[model samples]
Target chain A: MSFNVIGKSVIRVDGLAKVTGKAVYPQDIYMDGMLYGKTLRSTVPHAYFTLDTSKAEKIEGVVRIFTAKDVPGHNAHGVLFKDHEVFCAQKVRRIGDPLAFVVATSEKIAQKAVEAIEVKYEELPAVFDPVEAMKDEIKVHDGTSNIIYHYKLRKGNIEEGFAKSHVVVENVYKTSMVDHAFLQPEAGIAYVEEDGTIVVCAATQYPHFDQLEIAEAMGVPAEKVKVINPAVGGAFGGREDITLQIHLAIAAVATGGPVKAVYSREESFVAHSKRHPEIIKIKTGADKEGKLLALEAEIIADTGAYASWAINVTRKSGIHVTGPYVIPNVKVDAYAVYTNNPFCGAMRGFGATQVPIATEQQMDMLAEKLGISPVEIRLKNAFTKGSETANGQILTESVPLITCIKKVADALEMA
Target chain B: MKKRGKGIACIFYGTGYGNGFPDVSRAYAELQPDGKVAIYTGATEVGQGAKTALSQIPAEVLGLTVDDIIFINEDTSITPDAGTAAATRQTYNTGNAIKMAAEELKKELINIAVKELGLNSDAGLEMKDGKIYLKILPDKCITLAQIAAKQSEPLRTFATFTAQTVQIDPETGQGAPYWPYTFSACAVEVEVDTETGQVEIIKAAHAQDVGRAINPKMIEGQMEGGFAMAMGYVLYEDLGLENGRIWNNKLSTYIIPTAMDMPEIQNIIVEDPESTAPYGAKGIGEPVMIPVGPAILNAIYDAVGVRMTEIPVTPMKLLQAIREKEKQGA
Candidate 1:
């Protein structure tokens, strides 16, 4: 199509507003009658707690103090499952879980009121490893086994392929949990107006997704709950699931006045999601010619107290286990087990990021055994168009992968 | 004492699923009684040249200069929703929507001119700088103001579209869910220190399938910014949490890539315009950084013949790898 602008460089829409400091962030959403809201979180990772909200509510300048009971609709909010509680009523499974909350006329009052609130806790055994948790001695969530989801991939012939191979290698690797760490902490202003409509504004990604989830938690119609996104600092999939959105709506409906809640940098990191830490074990068999015959792999991921996209992450890791290469025989088992480690969900690079790190290392190892260059071994196995991935799906287009490998090899001058 | 070695990484991401969400964007061009065209759209400019690319679409469509048009509408109350300005879909999706709006406005203007003049000439009419002209007749034309005053109806245009994509099967994680995946690959050169295991990036070149460069300068910005972020991911950024509590929450504790940590980057564009996109654009935003970390790790191996195998390839890990290699030699 003949065009003048679709592919042209234009100035940004918010360049002037951001650069000149005119852009109004959520913290800038100040009004004449706005109250500050703060949650009282548990100090211990796992404990049984009973929180009394009366003391904080009776404090001077303090408004209504609420617990899990104050929630008009669903008291708990989570995307995949209804396991995580909005307010800790019985057990504080993780250290960052909110046990109670206080609302006050001033931000200082809110901070003071949170300190006035008292909680009694009995520390319980906390599980941090998925391998031990999967034994089901202790449950992160009640009744169910500690496993959220287990996925398996079986292809070609594993035992026969291994027996025919000249060399076999087995090793275990671990990938660490990382954070998105967007500049904007969890901050939002919500109020039930005179007409009884709840307006919530915050800096967030996936505004529509949060709007619908907040509606369900508040027992309000989706239209009545208008979630507006202010200027976002950054979100690398950190805001995909519901966070403080439902809590703000609840506090607003209970207080009957404008209420704003913002997490400090410490709270944002403690409460927000992180990447899953995976323990990957792999046994590979290859011929003397360096032709890879089979791969036997098992991976376990710590899904934390609730299954927050961790199962999907492990599945993605399993799918790309062989990397961007062709493997005839592949077997992979992935388990997303519940642990008391901090809740991990989505971050940048999603799931494929983890697999490449492990598989690429294995490729380097195979090259060492075969007395070939790392780039040479990858070029031999790199999937081109018409070549099927390990899952047997045809790659209809985009054979540039070999070229991608070649370009890097040429740039590195790897001989 | 610490000495730094250069490192490089390369990678890219799959474009979105074509489940076809409604991408309805509207831009109107109102030719004033005097000689001016004002453009309007709901495309919110969130720092990535949405307004500039959008304004150009209308100007190009109306056969007018870029300075002659004003694109309006970021408020959801006034403007139709153009899906969130993400995945670099604004220029491609909203730009096409604006062009359609301008074409519709031009069509109405020609119809009004024909009605007022009582001329049944379907043969030749084109929009040019505040005037609608008849190609066949030299003097048989009218200015846009003259045509609007003589007509009863207001000249305005609208367009709504959906950008569709398919999802890869959950089982296989294979699908062309994208019209075309925005592909970018990079090769990084790094120098690793044998003693301290500090890595430094020396030179880098990124080759990307930019669909078509909507804004060459903006594309370069995305490339360079992605380069820095990816470098941070591989070398510096980490969320140091201890026992579910963030140990390093503040900027002082958490490290991001600084200007001093940058490598010389050569950005290359491989344009294979998407058939379904506006001006054939696929998203160029997130894919820029997706492939970068791997490419840098790959380069680290090339320099020292060691597999870092993990993220934020710290000096401690590098020192250990060097020690292990020395022990094997012994």
Candidate 2:
């Protein structure tokens, strides 16, 4: 159906406002008597540290210094697993771990106060590899094993299917950790209104979720906390987790005045979650006709120190391990393991971006081993309507792989 | 020495949170006393032209011009919960809700026009270009302004659209994860510098079956932006963590592709309208980026007889692969 506006390329609604500098972002928000907030992060990765804030408290412009002890409500918050401490009490698990928070009259004073606050630490042996962390020896989070979440998918009899195969190929694929790299570093402003409502204006993807999490952390009713998102510079998924929402609210409520916090570029990197680094061990077996017979995979992802969206990412990785191919027999084990590394959570593609690099390469290798062209091999096993995936989901509509392959092939030939 | 080659990859993405996450959108439509229309919904516009597309729905349904509609959006205190503006659902889910609300308000206006103009039947009364006309008479009509001026009652509506999605089984991961899916294909040409180990993307051709293009120009913009980001993911961008700490903490240290690094791009839009979608449109935001990285990787292999399995295929890795291949051949 033709549409007057649906298919037309109309300009963005707020383009003029954005270009004309009329658009107000979280960083643009300012209030009278607002204290600039700063955090003192741990210098050592894993250690028990005692924070010395006596000298910093004597800073001329410093309003107040807060630690984990000053938190009136729960001191912990996370999206999937509430294991991260807002402010470390004694032990620091990662380099970005917050030891203390300072609020001062200016950002310059807050930075100086943060520098004056010294910390002493006794180092502990830390595990950095996800595979080693999976051995259940060095527990990243106390009590719980290093392996935070494990998911598996099984299909038809893999042994029987593999026995019928004529060729088998195995490969180990690795992917490094990456950042969202959104243009906007984390920034927010918080203040308590006259009606006793805590208001947080920030650049975030999800405002309602932020409000609830802040309310829960402040031990206030959900109605008492309001989160208003201004023009987000870019989210990609880094802003999905709490950056400075709860910390800003704590500062505002504690000092009984408005407070603003903006993460420097360096702080933004350590504070927000990163894409999980992965190790995928995959083996594929196919018949003489180049049809996939059996497949097996073991995917280990370093979720780093905390569980943000690790469970969901692991599950998605496991589900998409088979890629777009029609595989009847398959067995997959995907795990999100914890390590004393920078925490990992959501990125643009989450786990979807990692597994495809391996699976697609596996397909190319299989095609070469079978003495068939890449296009021919993929066309042989491309999914169609009524086709069931390794995870048992049936494709009912919009299965256009064959058409896409043909189109691309034609385009390449023409070029 | 430099060699050039081409490769292709395709991807299909599920739209919305289809795993039993109750997806719903609400919209409010009210025809004002001055003959202007107002739309209220909590759909945030994160630089995606949501307000433009949403206003089009009410304008098309009510037979009014887009300029005549005023949008009040993204305020939680005033607008109803239209769900999050993620998963590209604002155009489909929220657009449908606005259409329903506008249709309801149009019906109320037509009924008043019928009563005020002494029309024989409601069937002959039609609203077009902000005027109600009797189809049989053609000239016997009443303007929306006159209708509003004679309003004995309020003209407004509130409507909601809840997407029906199937929950996948937890154990098998089977079942319909989403209501509908969007499809895309990408073909990339690369020139591999064997000596320097640098791969230059000469050109890229991307085709997306958007089910329907809600806004063709917007879709093209999304394609260009997604492809550039994917180019960075495949060749240049890496977080480069050292001992759980960021090594390249600054933009100068962490390199992303500048405009000089961009390749020539061609975008092709395929329209196979989805029956259940608003304006028969499926999302193209996430699907456009999925196939690009793999296509670039495959193109690198095509250029040189080496397969680099990892991401951000760095120059050093490519040089090492070339050396390994040379030693094996020797």
Candidate 3:
């Protein structure tokens, strides 16, 4: 069981090439006869829009201007739900929706052409709040309910358990929308090879997933398109979803040459997904000795314009609502709602991050009511070797919450 | 006016895809005629030291130095799928596959060495540093060069390791969602500027159960890096949005912690080896950031006697909380 290098610190194999500035990112990619691509985004949050590219087609050096009618195959794709449009055909549900794409010989020409393209938009009522969206008065998407997904977890009887409680605390918590803010703005380049195969090199987290999605959108087989990720500046779950992969593929195939698109910092913020903004309501009850008796939680997440990872986030929120604590009776419901807002998806913590702010605060509240210190209350309710989580999984090993808290508490005391 | 206070938070994180996803990592190892090794996998480096940790595993198992290992990664057309480098599964799942492939190649080499040396049993033979030596008779050794020189075919093997987990109950959200979990706790000491509502982090300590440290220095880098990112998430970073559109869309408008903003960090690595992982390593990439925001929030509460519930607890927000508390007292 001895190892010479398994546990030893060795120099990174790719460090020298990166530190020496020899790393070739997707942005650095340049091919002869390449066309720069630019997207015209919707100005209004929600509206029915009609695009007119006749004026833009006359712009000098503009190769082509493609709209929703120009897409070869499927115009929509998403990580979880295929609701996001490559080019909006009728209605723009979010401000980031792509209305048209411009391909030109130069970036300036493409941008200028995008600005020249005329469009008329008829505004529609939009719902911005998840709770209000749940009312379904103004649905983000027509025909379907605003609630994208709802998950429920039922444990022991909440009524009986709450009746046995000596103290109860109720609270509501709100988490703000945060961007990934990765140093590298979303960038990619795509081209159709001589062999009629499409190739895409981009800053992405999942190349395989990107390949399949890109191929499907371009009306080609998965093998026809290849995705390669060069040196990424940073991706704290920001690159998990599709960025510029498909847009470049469509432009490349349509322009009959290499196509490159790099979002500016402002466009990058509007283009990519952000961490889900959620509102969590929690109620926890405990006995006089600080033994957790009952827990009830309802988490509503603003999934924004699409259901990218909304279902996954809501389920995870339901699973970890108790926050490393042991409770007998627990009931939880998590809902993801569609809204005409900035779309939210995976981030570093996923669903587990926001719920902790509520649960931990609830823990501290219980501590105050029980006349015990924060450390004592957490230790009292901490899951041990044989404890069962709110998700009903029995802990077998490596359950070290108590030990870790004690060490941190001890370290803080020493400091 | 400045006052000092401390707070602590502990949290658990799972490693691997979890949620009953078929999480698998596959690796291919081949021994070249020149005694070097080549490993092919789709694990992206992503500045996470994946290439280094992955190289170390095959090198350790095949009795070769890390310099002898060549990695072909990040190219889907060539490398086998090792699953994405996210979820901190590189060292655990991919490490196991690389080890298996290297061990398979080593078994073949040991058989060849036994036959070449005219040894009676292969049990006494051990490969170390590109040479096969008899433990009982160290002088009787054969180099990999000699074996490859006389070999009929090159040695190559493939391995795939799948995480063992159960699907959770759809309604209850209960089951073996993840194979193994990583636990981490962070404690922070903060000084609050009562007038300005700016909290200064004096020192911070983070202790994590990584199951095992494949590379202590790299794990330290992950800890400190996660701390810095989480610090920004707590105190500085916020994507200012108005009416569903980003207001501070540029980095110049948004704020993040620079080198000068980092506090003194005490990185502690707790090694509790997991039986299911490669060399007993459970990944620590994500767990390192889970408890950080809560820890700093608790510390701010302790210092200012106000609980700021939202993230990016800006100075203005703290000043408002302080004023609200004062108004209540008045």
Candidate 4:
């Protein structure tokens, strides 16, 4: 069909509404008899702990409070591994661990009540290094050792591939943990109706996933819980996981009333998930003619206190370590090691953004040794259809990596 | 190559979300008794013009003016699921649904006009702006409002779609994940100060295999936004953490690209239409940022003969690389 408006750059439908301050975010939605909710966070970095909320529950205007014991369903929710606690019960892992949820008549009273909650902890020396955290004796988590998940891309013989190369470049690159830092803080209002249906409206990216997790935490049927995405300031994959949705749900169901939970900017920084800090060791090999042969690398990702899709991050980092190229042989050892650092989850580039810094730079270094431009070396090896990746996966679909590379090469005239 | 250079970089990301989830979508359009065409869509405009896309798709479908179509969006009670407005999927996935709803309205209008006017057994009739016109006669016409009023019927229908997104094998990570892949490339030219190691992007161009330019100006905005973000990733943005807490917690510590940081963006949108898209269109959001980082770093290497292995090629890293060059010279 011919489109008159479809192909036009018309004004955003909500532009005027948002600009006029009429756009209602979750925080803007205020209902009658709504109580303020706040979470008590652990101060220690790592330890086994028990939080008693008796004193805080007795504070004036403090309606009700919930520890992990108050949660009726499973106490954990994570994308890959269900390891994170909805509320810390037996142990405090990270400094931002939520130990108790307090409901009060006002935000000021809730803040005061949160200070009254007492948490007992046996402090343990924490490990923040991705490499050394894997060896830490003080298990931050309950189950396995620090190594959460490992991903590998094993193809042709790596040693033989390097042997066939005229040049081999090795370098280690590191990227710090990055927060999504969406302008909107995590805000949500949760209320349980008379029919036992829990309604949670929040600034979230994934509504369906939030609905499922909120249902579990609320101890209700999945159909009973509804999550509506408010005008999210920005997500950048930050709000993909449930933040205030389940917590508000727990607070509402526990206190038996409507409750609003808003994370301050400082609280958001401490509690929210971040991009996995990656330490990637890249080793690239190219032939005399600048044809790439192999790229073997070891990558360690700090998954932090709990596993929050670090399994997939490790997997992606393992595959893209060789990058969008043709390599007859490639081996990538990618590990998501548990650490005392902030929890790491998804970001814009997934995990591929970190490795390119290493692998692409190695390509430039190899190009130098081969007396060729970095563009020339990449063009010679850019993966087209029929080229097998390091994971033994052949590109039968759109292998536009070379085409994209050429377009950019042409755009810049990097001949 | 001239010292002042231009380079191209192709950045491609399979923009549509992965395949495993339910690819559900629906859109409804109705002509009110007041002669206004209202289109109902569940696509949320998270600053990306999904409402305008909805308004446009139906206008093109039913041959109505864009101004005539009142778009009702992002309300599940009124609008059906057109899917989330992420991944640049609105122009294609939501577009097809809106087209179907409009087509149904067109068909119903033709039927009503054919039955009422006794027009030559309804052959070669075209619907334009809520009016049924005879293709052969070229002048015979009746307003849809009149036909709808005469027929004593409401003109409302819905269209649903399941845009195919084949999921990749979880192990190998290779599959035709996107229904139609949107391709983009960027080339950036940067000049580095030899002494201070300050680098500035001289020129930047983005060429995207957009399947179709749904809106060239919108694509330009995406390109400009991506460049700003990539500029931040290249020369500004960083997450400084100490112990377990982030040191750069505020804007004073963390910096993003400002207005002064923007370079002249040459946005080239290529449209080799995909058969499935509304007018052969694909998602083009994430691609804008994906390639700019490498392009800028590569340019830094060209400007100064140092390969910046890490990101935010800040003055310190550039200066240190320059110092290493000085040591070699000595």
Q: Which tens-of-lDDT digit does each residue in B1-330 have in candidate 1? A: 333333323343444323233444455667665645666655555444566667766777677766667665433333555655554456666777777777787777778767655678645776677677777774667787787676455566678756555444455334433334455566677777787788888888776666667677778887887778777776877667566565777778888787889888878766666566666666676667756776677667766767766677877887788789779889
What 10-residue stretch in candidate 1 chain B is worst by lDDT?
A: B1-10
Candidate 2 local lDDT, A1-415, one digit each (tens): 4456566676766678789988888888889888999999987778888988999999999999989998778888887678888788888888899888899999999999999998999988788999888887877878999887777677887898789888888888888787878887888898888998998888876666677778878888878887777887776667768878888999999999999998888899898998888899999888888899888999999998888889877876776778778888998889999998999987766677678778777777787788887777778888776677676666676666677667766776622
Ranking by DockQ: 3, 2, 4, 1
Give DockQ for candidates 1 onward, in order. 0.29, 0.48, 0.62, 0.34
Model 3, B115-204: lDDT tens digits are 888888898788889899999999889988788788777777999999987877778766777768777888899998889988888998
* lDDT (Cα, tens digit) per residue for candidate 4, span B1-330: 223433344433444444344566688888777666888876665555566656766777777776778887633435566765555567778788888888888787778778766786778887776678788886788886776576456678888877775545555444444455555567888877777677778788777777666667777777787778767776776767666666677767777777887877777666566677776666665566666777777677766677666667778887898789768989
Error of 4 at A4 (Å): 2.9
Candidate order by TM-score, decreasing, is 3, 2, 4, 1
Each candidate's root-mean-square deviation in Å? 4.6, 2.8, 2.1, 4.1
Better of 1 and 2 by DockQ: 2
Q: Model 1: runs farther than 4 Å from truth?
A: A158-171, A282-297, A326-328, A368-387, A402-415, B1-12, B17-180
lDDT by residue for model 3 over A1-415, one digit each (tens)? 6778877888887888888989888898899988999989998899998988988999999999888887788988898889988888999988888888899999999999999999899999888988999999998988999998888788898898889999999988887788878788988899888988888999877677787788888888888877787888777777877777887888888778999998999999888888788898889999999999999999999989988888877777777787888899999999999999988887777777777777887877787788888888888988777788877787787677777777777777732
Query: Which stretches of model 3 miss by more than 4 angstroms?
Result: B116-120, B138-142, B145-154
Better model by TM-score: candidate 3 vs candidate 4: 3
lDDT of 4 by residue, A1-415 (tens): 5555556776655577789998888889898899999988888788878766788888899988878888888887876677778887777777788888888999999999899888789987887777877775767776678997767556778899999888998887776676766678888898887888787878765565666777776667788876666676776657766666777888887777789988888788877788787888888898899998888899999988878768766766665677667788877778998888888887666675566667766777787788998678878877666665554545554455555566656666677
Supply the TM-score for candidate 1.
Answer: 0.84
